[model samples]
Target: MDYIGWAWLFVIVVCIVIEATTMGLTTIWFGIGAIVAWITSGLGFRLEVQIFVFLVVSILCLVLTRPIAVKKLKIGKIRTNADSIIGECVKVITTINNINNEGTVKARGQIWSARSFNDEVIEKDEIVCVKEITGVRLIVERKK
Candidate 1:
């Protein structure tokens, strides 16, 4: 209708394009906001009111829906085999000395480079619990 309506339409199109390309569940809310703004412009609302509605609606949509959308879409980190190894008990194949930076452990029938989680020396053949994996190395702690 008016120039403001055309501008709001442009915003909506740009937001939709960005959302499609990224699939990030972010810009779609802005597109929804722009649609409302476009309707406001068509209804002869002032420019300031239209812009304020756009911003408030966009922020509310994002805050309210983003978390639910992420949970439903399973968009966060996916667990892997390495993640599964955390908290597993393994035998130290080599003396674990964080100061020396030399150690290995056997877990799930495979040997992995190891480090002491608390910087304590672990003797070979001792049982240790896998605490975390960093790069190719497993951070371990003495089995209690």
Candidate 2:
């Protein structure tokens, strides 16, 4: 009905579009806030009051619901095949020398370039545990 109402409508549309594209449970709260502000503007509320309501409502929605929404939606990082090898024991097929940058290990029937996690030299035929994967190389530490 007014310029403030139009602005709130625009904010609502933009927030909705962003939420739709990301699906990350963000921006939806701001859309809700904008809707409230739009209604406030339609009710002849002052611009300052409308803005304050928008901010408070948006922050309250985000703080009160985001964690619960994230938990219920099970939104979290998805592990990959490489992540599964972390903490797995593997046999070093070649000497691991961080200085020389030469090493190999066999894991799950696959040979992967390996490196010592702490830059220590690990002799060939030693048992090591996979610590992390960087690019095509596996960072390992000698098994106790």
Candidate 3:
């Protein structure tokens, strides 16, 4: 085995091991691509062409099929309900008025101080949707 072939093999093996550790399949495609490069190296391709093949295939796998990994891999939060209210629907317990950003909302059955995405206070009994969360404050918008 020549230096080019050895290098390609090494690259493939390392990528595969990393892919195993993460199991997201993000780098497994790269590993497969590297194996392709390794096979090409054994077929008398120059180091430059092998490297090019390695790079092109790796990038193609990453860019083209990245959505597969994105869809299969769920990198969501496993935290408590408090952090989960960011996307929940809630009813305002206090009005969100101008000037002062003071309001409350019942989110997931828990009352929390809610702030408008505009930083305004929401009025009581108003329905709002949680857009996102910031610390203990909820960034909400009027339901309508």
Candidate 4:
């Protein structure tokens, strides 16, 4: 009803918008704090008390719940479409001799430059698992 209440409402809306845009979990805590401050203002609390309540509640929410929320939200390995190919089996289209610096692999229907992870010479058509990626090259190991 008062200016404090309006200000807190604005904060809540802005924070929510930022959270939705980035999905980074950064400002939702401030939104929760603004809600508490809005309610405090509605209950006729002084401006200083409202602000204090907002800061304390916001910090508490961030410190107490953020880690748990992040862990729970991470249900499985988070990977982009390109990164999802890591650990997948691929066929060596070209000989992968780390010493000779020649290697290529066909992964996900795309030819990618590759290197042997253990420095072993891998001949063409051998199946290898992608271990990691560095720059434009796939680090690969023999598939066990």
Root-mean-square deviation of each candidate, in angstroms?
A: 3.1, 3.2, 5.1, 3.6
Alpha-carbon local distance difference test for all models = 0.94, 0.95, 0.80, 0.93
Tens digit of per-residue lDDT, candidate 1, span 42-90: 9999999999999999999999998999999976556678889999999
Better of 1 and 3 by lDDT: 1
Which residue pairs overlap in candidate 4's backbone? none
lDDT (C-alpha) at residue 143 in model 1: 94
| Pairs that collide, model 3 | 94-123, 94-124, 95-122, 95-123, 95-124, 96-121, 96-122, 96-123, 97-121
The order of the candidates by lDDT, greatest first, is 2, 1, 4, 3
Error of 2 at 10 (Å): 1.0
Displacement of residue 29 (Cα, Å) in model 4 is: 1.1
Pick out the ten consecutive residues of candidate 4 with the lowest summed lDDT: 74-83
Candidate 1 colliding pairs: none
Model 3 misplaced stretches (Cα beyond 4 Å): 22-25, 72-98, 109-111, 116-144
The C-alpha stretches of model 4 lying farther than 4 A from their native spots are 75-77, 80-89, 95-102, 120-137, 142-144
Predicted structure 3, TM vs. truth: 0.56
Residue 24 error for model 2, in Å?
A: 2.4
RMSD of 1: 3.1
Task: Count residue pairs with overlapping backbones in model 2.
Answer: 0
Q: lDDT per residue, candidate 2, 27-96, as tens digits?
A: 9999999999999999999999999999999999999999999988876655568889999999999999
